[model samples]
Target chain A: MEPRPTAVRPPIHLRIADDIRMQIERGELPPGAAIPTLAEISERWSCGMNSARGAVALLRAQGLITSGRGKAPVVRIPPRRVIRSSERHQIEKDLALKPEAERGAIGEAETNLNMSIGAQRFSSQYDQVEAGPELAKVFGVEPTTLMLRRQWEATDPNTELRLSWSVSHIPLDIVKSNPALLDPNNEPWPGGTQHQLSTVGVEIMKMVDEVTARMPTTVEAQLWGLPEGVPLIFCRRISIDGDGRVIETSDADYPADRTELHFVTPLRPWPKRRQA
Target chain B: MEPRPTAVRPPIHLRIADDIRMQIERGELPPGAAIPTLAEISERWSCGMNSARGAVALLRAQGLITSGRGKAPVVRIPPRRVIRSSERHQIEKDLALKPEAERGAIGEAETNLNMSIGAQRFSSQYDQVEAGPELAKVFGVEPTTLMLRRQWEATDPNTELRLSWSVSHIPLDIVKSNPALLDPNNEPWPGGTQHQLSTVGVEIMKMVDEVTARMPTTVEAQLWGLPEGVPLIFCRRISIDGDGRVIETSDADYPADRTELHFVTPLRPWPKRRQA
Candidate 1:
C-alpha cells in the first residue's frame, strides 16, 4: 500500500538518515569509518545543523553508527559472532558416555568459542534455592520445593568481559544422590550438564529451546557493556527425559549483536518419490 | 560485585519504575489494568510530579505500559504467543507423501497458528526477480540470474492484524518446468514449499535457520503495529538438497512480544551406558 500523501515527503532528517544508511549498506561507508560531519551533512542535504544532528541521532538509535559527546560518529564495527548450534546437544550427550579423561579434554564452551581454553576464565557456583512460582509451575512442583541452582560464566581473562553467562535449575530430588553434582568444584564437569544428569540415571531425550528478545535493563546493560541499540537474546531450554519429565531448565542471555543461534532440522525422506 | 556507593543510589524515578515493574511481575498489577494515576504515584512514592511522570515514561520505553494523550496509561497486555516449532519440518515432509485429499486438509500456516482456517486471510504473490548480490552469493549464481520470489502473508480476517509474513526465494531454473509452482494461485498448496519442490526432482535434506533480532524501522513497526520496545525476530531458513546445494531460502519475521520460536533437538543415543 502507498504511504499517505502527507507523509510521502518524510521529514528532512529521515531523508538525510536514509541517504547515509543507503551509503553504508552499499559499502561506500565501511565499518569503523567516520560518518559525514554535521557541516558536511548540512551542506549536502541543504539543511540546517539541527537537521544534520537529528540525522546522526537517528542512526545512533538504530545501531548503525556510534558517537560520543564530542567524537565524530562512525559506522558501527559489528562484533564477531560465535555461532551456537543445536548439533552440540548431541555431541555433548555422546561425550557423556565416554571415559571421564576423554570428556575432560574438551569443554563445550571451548568448542563453541573455537578458542584455546587458557584464554578464558571460567567459574561455577552451585546452591540450593526454593523453586519460585514461575519455575514451580514449569516443573509442576510446589513453590517452595528445593531446587538446585547453578550459575556458570566464561569471561575473557584480560578484559573480564563476559563471553557466556547462563543459569541452570534442576529439582534437588533428582540429583541429590550424586555428591559430585552438588559441588561447584565438579564443574567444567567433564561433558557438561548432559553428563551430570547421566550420573543420576536420567537420560535427556529431547531439548526444547524457546527463544525471544528484549532490551536489557539498565544494570544488565552495564554488566554486559552492551552498545546503545543492541538487544539481548533470551533463551530458556527445557530438557525432557524419556518419561516426559522436565529434567532440567537452563536460562541464557546472549548479546544480540554478536550471537547467532543456528538450528538444523533434518527432513524425513520422501517415500517412493514421484518426479514430474 | 557490589555496585559503587555513588552508583548504588539510582535516581528516584528508576526506583519507582522498578517497584511498579515488580508489581507487574508478581501479578499484583495485571495486564490491561490502568496503572496508578500520576497523582497517586506522586503521593505514594513521596516524589514530585515530574519524577512520577518520568517513571511512567520509563515504563513505556521498556514496553511495559501503553499511554495515549488523554487516556490513562495501562499495563501492556501481552499477546498469546503462537509457538512455531522446528519439528514441523519433518511433519510437512511426511505429509507430502500422503494422498492429495489428506494433504488438502492441512495448510502449513494453519497448523502453526493452531487456529481455524476460516479465521485468517492468506495471500501469496509470485514474481521473477533478479538475484541481487546478497542472494546470488547464497545461491552461487550470477547477480543477474532469474530467481522466483514468493511473498506470503496471513492476517486475522476481522482485525487485519498480521498472523504471519514471509518471503521465499528459489532459482527459476530449479522448477521452471513446473508451471503450477510459479503461479501464486496455487498457494496454500497441499503440502508447502517442501512438497512443491518434490514435484521436481529435489528433496530437501536439511534446513538451517539463522536467527537474529533488530529494532524495526518506522515503516515496519507501523506495518506490524508493534509497540515502542518490541523488537522483530528475523529468521532466515536455508534449505539444502541432498547434494548440499542451497535450494531455497525463506525469510520470516516474528514480533518478539507475541511470538516464541521453539527449536527441538533430539540427541543421538549413547553407544553404551557407562555407570558413574
Candidate 2:
C-alpha cells in the first residue's frame, strides 16, 4: 500500500543524515572511510552548513561514525567480536571437577577474553549486605539474610578500559563454610566461581541466562570509550544447584559492537515413525 | 586508587544530566514521573535555560526520558517485556511432529506474542534471489544458488506498529519438492517453517542463535514508535538438519525496550568423586 500522502517529510538535517546513514549501511562509505566534508555535503544537498554539521553530529551520536575533537569524521570500523557462548556453562562445570593443576591452566580469564589471567589487570572486591526483597525472592531467604556481593573486573592494561565486568551475589550462608572464599586476594580464583562453590560442596546444575540491551549512561560511555549508537548488552546468569537452590546470580555487560552472544540448542529426535 | 586528581570536570550540562540519570537509576525518580521543568532546573542549578535544555536533550538522547513537542518531559516507563527463549527451539521441533489439529493451536503468533494468529494483521511476502557470498557461506551453497526469501510481519492493529518481524531464507532447491513452500498464502502455515520443511524430508536437528544489538535507524524508530535511546536486538537463527546441512536461516529483530532473550543451559554432573 502507498504511504499516506499527508505524512510529513523529515527535517532537512535528518534527511541528510539518513541518506549518509544508508550509504554507510550499504557499504558505499566503507569503514574507516572519511565522511564527506561539510562543504561537499551542503553543496550536494543544497543545505546550509549548520544542517550539514547536524547530520554529522547525528551520525556520531548514532555510533555510525567516529571523530576526535578537530578531526575529520569517518565511518566506524567495527571491532572484532568475541563470542561468549552459552556452552561455556558446561565447560565451567567440567573445569570445577578437574584437578587443581589442570584447572589452573584453564582459568576464567582464558575462557572469557582469550588472555592469560596474569597478563591482564584483574580485581575482585567482596562485601556483604542484607538481602532486600528483590534478593530475598531470588534466594528464597528472609529479607534479613546477609548476601555476599563480589564485584570482578578485568581491564586492558594499555587502554585502562574494562575488558570485562561482572558482579555476583550469593547468600553468605552458602559460601561462608569456606573462609578462603571470602578473601579477595585469592582470585584470579582458578577454575573461577565454580571451583569456589565446589569447595563448599555446592554443585551448579543449571544456568539460566537472561539478556537485554540499553544505551549506556555518559559515565559508562566514558569508561568503555563507547562511540555513540552502540548499545550495551546485559546478561544476568542465575545458577541453580541440584537441590533446587539458587546459588548465585551474576550480571555482566558487553559492548554490543564487539560481542556476540551465541546459544546452541540441540534438539531431540522425534519418536520412531509409525508404520509407513 | 586515590592518586588520580588530574581528571577534568565534566561540563555543567553533562553534570546535571548525570545527576538526574543517577536519580532515575536509583529509582528516586521513578518511571513516568515528570522531569523538573526548565525554569525549575535553571533556578536550581543557577544555569541558563539553554544549559537546562541541553541537559534534558541529553537525557532524551540516552532514552531515559520521553517528551513530545510542546509537552513536558517524563521518565520513560518501559513496556512489558515478552520473553523469547532458546528452549522454544525444542518446543517448535516437537510441535512440527504433532497432529495437524494440535499444530493448528500453536502458531508462531501464539508462541511469540501470546496472541492468536487471527488477532494480528499478519503478512507474508515470498521472493527469490541469488545467494550472496555471505548467505552462501551460511547455507553451504554456491553463490549462484537460488534461495527463497520470506518476509513475515505481524502488526498490532491499535498501534499500527509491528509486534513481530522476521525474514527467513532457504535454498530453493531444498524446498522446491513442495511447491506449497514457495507460496506466501500457505503461511500462517500450520506448524510454521519446521513443519513446512518436514514435507520436504528435512528434520532440523540443531539451531544456533547469535544475538547482538544496535541503535535503530530513524525509519525503524518511527515504525516501532520507539522513544529516543531505545536499542534493537537482532537475533540470527541458523537451522541445521540431521545431516548437518543448514536448512534455513532466519533473522528477527526485537526492541530492547520491551523484549528479553533467555537461554537455558542444563549442565551435566561431574564424574563421581574418586575414593578420598
Candidate 3:
C-alpha cells in the first residue's frame, strides 16, 4: 500500500504554493481571477503569516500571477504569442533576388511583429571592433582581425521599450568591398542581410540557428516589461557561404512568454518500395 | 543625461543580488566558489540579516548558485550540455531504409546521451485516449478521436533520475493497421519512430519543431534534478507526411542549463551571377 500523505512533507510555503498553482492550472482560478488573500491562505493552510507571504512571493516569481504593492494578485493572463518561423530564411533569401520595388515593399519588422516600421522607431548603428578571442574563434579569424558590428533595434516610441533587437557581426575583410554595408545610413537595406551579402558577390548557402533560454536579469526584466518567471529565448544565427565559410553571425533575444520559435525540417524521401 | 545610482534604489536585496550577479558574469566569483555569507552580505551592504538572506535566495532561484541545509552555497558549475540538433531528423529518416542489422545497432539513448541503452533503464507505456478538444484541433480530428498515446523515458538506474523523456501521440486510425505500432512490447523498434510510421504506410516528409521555455514546476524540478535558476526547454515536434497531413506529435522537455537545440536551414542558392 502506498504511504499516506502528511507523514513527510516539503516546506510549508512550497506546499501552499503548489496547492495554489494547481488551482491555477486546473482553471479553478482562471486567468484574471484573484488569488486568495494572506489571511485566507494562512487560515486555509493553518500556516503562519510568513508562510503565506512566501507562498505568494513564490507564485509571483513563478510568473503565475501578477501583483504589485497596491494591487491584489491575480492569475496571469498570457500574452498573445508571436511565431518566428524558420521558413522566413528562405523568404529572405528569395527577396534578395526579387525586383527592388518588391523588396522595398516588405520589411522584417512588419512581418515579425505584425506592425510596420512606420509605427515604431527603427535604428541601426555600425562600428568596427577587434574580434577578440571568443568572436575570433567563432569566425575562424585572428584576434587582431577587425569586425564590423551592427546593432539594429525597433522600439515603441510611446513606451520607449524595444519591440525587436539584434546585433550582427561580420569580418571587415568580407564586406569592406561594399561601402554601403558598412554605413548605418544605408539601412533598412532593402532585401535585408542576404541582399547586403549579395551586393558584395557573396552567396549564403546555409544558416544554423542555435537556441537556448535563461531567466531575465532585473535590468532585462524592466527593459522588456516582463513579469517574474519569464525566460528569454536566445538565438545565434550563423550564415554560411557556399564554401562552408562562416560569413556573418547575428544574435537576438525574444521573450519566451510571447514567442514561439518554429523550426521546419524537410526530409528526403525514401526509395520506392522502401516503405514495404 | 544618465542619472547616477544610489538616488533610485531598487530594494536592498535586489541591489545585493545584482552585485553578486555582476561578479558571476565577470568571473570574479568563479564557478564553485563560495558565495558571501549572510553576515558578510549584511555588513557589506549595510543591510539587515533578512535582506541578506533574501539576496542569497534570489541568487539561488536565478540558478547562479547551489545550496543545501548543511552545505555552503557556491556558484553553480554548469553541467555538460547535450545538443539536440534538427539534423537528426534526416538521420532518422535515412536510417529507416538501412539494413536491419545496422539500424538495430543504434538506439536513441546512445545517440542522445552518448551512453549505451544497456547502461540505463528504459520504459514505454502504451495507452488509448480520446484526443480531446485541444489535441483534436491539432490533428484536425474529432474530439473523441481515439489516439494511441505512448510515453517513452530513460532513467539512470543508480540515481533513478530521468535521462530523457517524451510523449508521442498518433491518431489510432493512422497506425492501427500495424498492430506492432500499438504494442509497447515492440519497443526498441529497429529504426525508432520514423521506421515505425513507415510500417503503417506513413511517410514523414516534413517535421516542425515548436520550442518555448518556462520555469519548471516544483515536481518537475525534483524529477529533473534541476538546481535553482534553471528553466525547462519545451519542444513540440509535429511530423507531416507528403500531403502535409499531421501523423504524429511528440512533446519533450530539456533542462535549459544543459541542453542546446540546433536548427539548420539550408537556403536555396541564388541564381548564378545574380550575386552581383
Q: Give candidate 3's TM-score.
A: 0.94
How well is each residue in B60-95 modelled by candidate 1, as lDDT tens digits? Answer: 767788866689989999988888889888887787
Q: Rank the candidates by TM-score, best first.
A: 2, 3, 1
Better of 1 and 2 by TM-score: 2
DockQ, structure candidate 2: 0.67
TM-score between candidate 2 chain A and the true chain A: 0.93
User: CAPRI band of model 3?
Assistant: medium
Query: A81-101 in candidate 1: lDDT tens per residue?
Result: 888988888887888888889
Q: Fraction of the real A/B interface contacts present in each candidate?
A: 0.63, 0.76, 0.75
For candidate 2, write residues A84-168 as lDDT tens digits.
Answer: 9889889988888777888788867676775666778988899999988887998899999998999988887766778889999
Question: Which consecutive 10 residues in model 3 chain A have the weakest lDDT in total?
Answer: A1-10
Model 2: per-residue Cα lDDT at residue B268: 87
Q: Supply DockQ values for each candidate.
A: 0.55, 0.67, 0.67
Error of 1 at A45 (Å): 5.5
Worst 10 residues of 3 chain B by lDDT: B1-10
lDDT of 2 by residue, B1-276 (tens): 544334789888999999999999889999999989999989998999999999999899889999667899999998889999889988888888888888878876776885666778988899999989999998878999999999998887766888888999999999999998888877678788888888888889989999999988877887878888999999999999888999899999999999999988888887786221
- For each prediction, how big is the interface RMSD? 2.1, 2.1, 1.7
What is the CA-based DockQ of model 3?
Answer: 0.67
